[model samples]
Target: MEGHKLGRAPNFTGACIVMFGVNLGWILLLLFAVYGLVAAIFLGLVVNHWVSWLEHRKQLADQRYGDVSGDT
Candidate 1:
């Protein structure tokens, strides 16, 4: 098929570079989101453990000192 040239053919090198950049950007963004999600979950677990430990210590203290106060 004899086709007339449209203005100018698109540059293959430029297209490839643009696509590579876009894919790299998306990959980086996805990695960052996953890292943040994992970090948040880890921090939440740590906080929960810390709170439980504090509660346990408080209970132990009260159990030991409760006999001395006659304020039942």
Candidate 2:
């Protein structure tokens, strides 16, 4: 009955080194919060496939320059 007596200030080997440093800092902050949520869902699917490839290259340059209506 002599396990470094536990009756005063946290003494069972300092409460097992503060419960193994708080369970290794909560398992390294839960693996860096699941790698920052899988890098924010692959950076929002690469910025929504680069804004849908720049709106399909501005509708193929307004069908090769013929749209702003000045009667072609």
| Tens-digit lDDT track of model 2 for 8-37 | 664487788699769756755675577775
RMSD to truth, every model: 26.7, 25.8
The CA lDDT at 25 in model 1 is 61
Runs off by more than 4 Å, candidate 2: 1-37, 48-52, 69-72
Count clashing residue pairs per candidate. Answer: 0, 0
Q: With candidate 2 superimposed using the best TM-score fit, by how many Å does residue 62's alpha carbon deviate from the native?
A: 0.5
lDDT of each: 0.71, 0.71
lDDT over C-alpha atoms for residue 29 of model 1: 62
User: lDDT of model 2 at residue 39?
Assistant: 62
lDDT of 1 by residue, 12-58 (tens): 98789799769756755675687876665665567669879997987
Name the runs in model 1 displaced over 4 angstroms: 1-35, 67-72
Q: List the residue pairs that clash in candidate 2.
A: none
